[model samples]
Target chain A: MNPTLGMYRPRNTPMHQAPAWFKAVLLVVIAAVFVLFTDPITSVGLMAACVLLLISTGPPLKATAQGLLGIVIIAALSGGFHVWRGEIDRAIDLAADLVGLVALALAVTSSTPMEHMLDLVSRILRPLRRVIPPETMGLMFAITVRAVPEVARMMSESRSAAKARGLDRSFRAVLIPTTTRTVGFALDLGQALHARGIAEEGDNPAPYRRARRVKH
Target chain B: MIEFLDAEFTAPDSGARILEPTTLTLDERRISIIGANGSGKSTLARMINGLATPTSGSVRVDGMDTVKQGAKVRRVVGFLFTEPSSQLIMPTAIEDITLSLRRSIKDRTEREAAAMQILGDIGLADKADVSVNALSGGQRQMLALAGVLAITPRIIVADEPTTLLDLRWRAHVGALLRSLPLQVIEITHDLEAAARAQRTIVVDHGAVVFDGDPAEAVEYYRALMLDRAVGEPAT
Candidate 1:
């Protein structure tokens, strides 16, 4: 079966037992640190740390490699560009940073339940209710994350559809339907939300000033 | 009760009337709408909860105006669409139900508990944390229905809810839908299901052609289709 996006994989690791919010915040801090670092030796250290962290989560290493395949390819191409520019050390550093960042992200995602993560986010954003509804934003964030897989599926399907009729050479025919279907999906999604009466945020901007204190 | 007071609907794109002016008072616990594709039955059903607002008139649910009190009206009416995928927006089943309960239950712990109870009611407690994309079609549809029912809406408006399921799943889904305690307004192609409703409505060419007992209404619709079949020249 295809791996679920940002879904919890029931594991009894220490990371799995860690608070979802803590892991979420930690991932962001880790990403920022990786972005700031520049040296290959330091980045290699970071990559080793991330690998140890990922190993603690106890998922199969082969599965991790498969999940990180895209990251590997991109990192290779990016690192190769640095080497082509006569910066071999820089190439290794860049690849290490990329790989470390993605590994940490995957580790965090696999450890925490997505809903727990989103709920914590919603609570943290509650004070900004006057500017925007925190709950709605949380829902949007989850939807956006889930949409990545949906969009990916659509892309593969579009390629196969184009190849079926030997219209693979025609970008117009393939791109048009892919783009059109994405828009259609949005429209259908909007209608579905409306039907479910979950369009509460967009219709009412910010009336949080008048909101009464309710028990959480 | 859901009431349509001379409601009319015009297609925004075509600028043509899809639902002619119609007046109805729906108080039945179970009412089914039967019609051919694009025959305005969905347009009528949507008006109840303000999914499709009346172009010229008004729709009221238990005296609450659907347009003026759109949000409030929506709180009372839950909708189930033909395609379940659109309804399962969250990655996992529990999360989707939790989303439904966000308005009602503010506490995250309480909301999760409530969602779990709803899932258990729908026989999906074991699959709570499982991604919805991984579920079978019948399970997905059941989860979608569970999401709607989680909020405890007063009425459920299902537009061809079983159209996408295979025979067994279709029967299973239809039975599950019929067994709901709340008032249900279903628009469907299944005459057998339609036959079980307290009342049935028939729409044709964007208008209500028949409304009465389920047996008579289904008979009228079948006869109308048969007549059209014989009257029209073979292609």
Candidate 2:
């Protein structure tokens, strides 16, 4: 599966130009509809529509298919489980529903930049600004998204380090280093955030004030 | 100008000295700090931007107290880390730079354009939308620098920024840092790079053991290392 499947791919398609909040709402509504519909043919048709929508976003079809491989495996396993229970029609509907939902979700994610999503989130949560700063939540979301590949890289590095030391078979050997590295990464990230003046904007600069005006 | 007015740092829990009391005014366009590991070089550099506050005396950048005016100080100072991955908070190059401009540029399209412009200047224009994970170590460091530059800071404090890079990337990043039109205080183990600075300070045992010409500071640090090696028992 493609590690970068959900990450925005630069494109000039209509999907890319659509507002992030609109796509988010559409994704939610479509997901709800997919769950409500139990017919195999309808589910398969919806899955095809999702696939078409994803293709229209202009990302490489081969790469997109590769990214959906893990989902396909999960859907197949689920279908097999349902078939074992003597529910052939239910198996097809469930498998199609899973694939369709994942595709639609990917369509939204691949076309929308993370910053736009954060902006949408900040607007949604702006009312709760007193209790929880939307900017802090946005930072948390960005960091969590950023850490996905980093954790994957660290895990591989830890595994390699274990293998080099002839401890490849030991799960503890790999886990320890990976966990330590993750904690260290988090600390460094916090320090970087501090250095960048994030969460410390008491006396906002002229450009910042002007920018806030522009944003509003 | 950055001033360390008899500033000192002590471990909060252990009450051990991390940086000994010292006073220095730094106004040079390029100043390098060199020291052994755990010798308080990072502590000194970090204080300039208020990442680490002094335990007793105060540190000021252009007369703004680092502790009291931390946010203001941070605005004037941009910091670069040894590990670029740590500094990068976004998945893509353009997005990371845009994140840096989040405060300064409110308009989304204009901010993205500004980020793209920075990427082009840094020769990462083609990789603007590429995932940062796909970048080379050198390119990642360059992107990290781009993120720092997005704020248009007056001073930059880099703590071992090139220590993680290969020889080629090290030279590239070192040259880039030198060419930047701002005050730079770098903490590095690279004696050659240290010598390129206008002035150099040597830290040892949590004290500024030597502060003068870059060449002389390097020589003093080398001699100090040799002296320590000769005096210590062999492991």
Candidate 3:
């Protein structure tokens, strides 16, 4: 099984021990600053600061490098577009903005456990418990976070299944089974929720109605 | 007792009959159901918890109608799916079990404590906070079991729980299932595991063709498969 992206490393460092809310707030502030300030000059400074923060995390070098490689691929295309337009300055600044955000997010993710992140999300959504089950929101986040790597695993399995059947070159052969299995996964999830008593009535915890009541 | 009275299933898309009408009262502590793929055994097992509600008639657990009292029925009838990864919804081990305890325990610390105890039970105490993605197949299955057991259901309906496991994990999970004090209804293709059950039911072409001792049911299933393999219609 593939480890989720930016896995949390259980460490005793100050950043690792920081409250999830604090990191979340910091992430929001970073986002807000980027949104509010459009100047390329400021973005370059922001990028440099994010790099320092990333280094301070003492990340697993391999994962960070792999993450950066992916980031560079996307940023390179966009940066090339800007450079070709004769806006070299804009190209540099845009790359900084892109890399800065990813580095910040990665640093935060590496420091905080997903449980803490979900708890923070649950607490934030507490006020909405009246209209939506707040805890269910956190569960939704957990499921989504868990599903990504699982989806990747399923894709690989589907690919293997296709190769065994000599249909490796056909996209439809892969897509059909992957899609079906994913749908089955979702259906099974509902049954698991119901069996766990998570979908009880008035549980309104996210508008999920229980399985249809059998008529007499 | 988990009872099915005239319970049946019909696939909506193909309008194909998935399970024929059947009636039985099952109260055995360890019951096994065996059938070939697409034989409707999973459908029959799922009916106990309303996962596959009968298209006609009804299923009841301990006098509680599965459909009318589904929430209550579910609270007492734990279900373990074949895929541990699909069932382990939370990000971490303790978190998944804690989520299971959410309805039963309100206090966060207390809930987590109980979850830790459960992980300890399954020997995953050290991995309590580890990402579920990092778990091996056996560990993941154990975690899934911990979540289901955390609910303390009176009866457990397992739908091919060991299908995805390796030889070691199969025996490990099989022993874990057998050791539970609760009543268990397991659907499996493993004849050896089926033989451990007090009773077994064999399903074929969406019908319960045999309901008797596990040994006999296993023989019946083997014969049925042999017939199909030889291009002869099953009797």
Candidate 4:
């Protein structure tokens, strides 16, 4: 039920202070380079660097472990798949690269606060203002980050309620209520948006529209 | 006056008749609807905001037809549910309220300012930027109220808004609702809240069995409950 996007453990580390966009761009670059090249030394070096970065970020070891659970499973599956195909070295390298990239990104999120991350994203997106309003993108990122936990909480509660009612195993029992609750939540959010005047006026394009325009 | 003309509702799941045919007019500003679970009180409140349309009957708010003008009616009738968490859509407190003003203000700065003003009014201005998940129960309810109030609705419909809170928070929220300037229609089991309202309606078996002054309505409901308990004993 932990719906949070990542375990953003708050810390006063240097990595947290670094701009989020910098980390984002770095992650993309590393991922692309790792995938394109087959140098085992370079992959090992990157993996070592990511481990060091994660240790310095100072998140609870337990939280870090839980957050990386998915990445670990994916890495294992890919590595096993490669070994099954008799490409052991290539599999190990691919797994190392993928894990290194994911760990680096997780370190950034774990160290940085959502507000700062949003600010960094907005700053990076500022040039595309003519196409996409930076503020809207910033707000959207903040909301997405915040909603992760909220949605997870909702799903957990729904599951519990379904279990208590002895209908947890029934798809109709679970799906119908969960979907209804989700839609209800969305509508309530929409109403909240309307009340707070977040809706775009007839003349104004949506914030995403601006972002899209900049990309074009 | 709020009026329901031949109100009847069919359950969405089984298509069973839920609300029996009925008609009533409510003129009092503060009214409470009390009923047991599945007694149809919640459905009755939802009908006011057009959240639930009657299968055959018609609901009117100050003479505006709920079925014919559902959207317009919703603008004037702000609905609050017992679970504030479900009602809250936005991640942060101020952002949630700001979202409600999306149509009223074009400028982001102005919208934020207005949202802050509302938070201040609700005594939550300091928590404007805070994530809503971090809020206490009372604070979350206040934020939910702020979200509803940001729209400047004239009527507020709350379905057991305080049922989840502790005794202190329950009283706090009840008092706050009673003090608001908007017309309040509260569906609750809290007898203390019923005492504060100008009028009360007791619903049983999907029908309004009692309607009048709060004192009389409470007495009637208490008697009905007692009779049911005694008569159904050992069954």
Q: Best candidate, TM-score-wise?
A: 1
lDDT of 1 by residue, A13-96 (tens): 999999987888888887777778877788899988987887788766775777778788999999999999999988998899
Query: Which stretches of model 2 miss by more than 4 angstroms?
Result: A38-41, A61-63, A85-94, A203-216, B13-15, B233-235
Interface RMSD (Å) of model 2?
4.9
Fnat per predicted structure, each in turn: 0.52, 0.76, 0.61, 0.21
Kindly report, for each predicted structure in the order presented, the TM-score of its chain A compared with the true chain A: 0.85, 0.82, 0.80, 0.75
Candidate DockQ values, in order, are 0.42, 0.47, 0.54, 0.19
Evaluated at residue B35, the lDDT of candidate 4 is 80
Error of 4 at A11 (Å): 10
User: Between 2 and 4, whose DockQ is larger?
Assistant: 2
**Ranking of all predicted structures according to DockQ, beginning with the best and ending with the worst:** 3, 2, 1, 4
TM-score of chain A of 2: 0.82
Query: Which ranges of candidate 1 are over 4 A from the true structure?
Result: A1-5, A60-63, A168-170, A199-216, B231-235
Supply candidate 3's per-residue lDDT for B6. Answer: 96
Q: What CA root-mean-square deviation does each model show from the true structure?
A: 3.8, 4.4, 3.1, 6.8
Clashing residue pairs, backbone N/CA/C < 3 A, model 2: none
Lowest summed lDDT across 10 adjacent residues in model 3 chain B is found at B226-235
What does candidate 4's lDDT look like per residue over B24-48, in tens digits? 8877889999988888898888888
Candidates 1 and 3: which is better by DockQ? 3
**Comparison by lDDT, 1 against 4, better one:** 1
Interface RMSD of 4: 7.2
Residue by residue across B123-157, what tens digits does model 2's lDDT show?
Answer: 99999989998899999999999999898999999
Full candidate order by lDDT, most accurate first: 2, 3, 1, 4
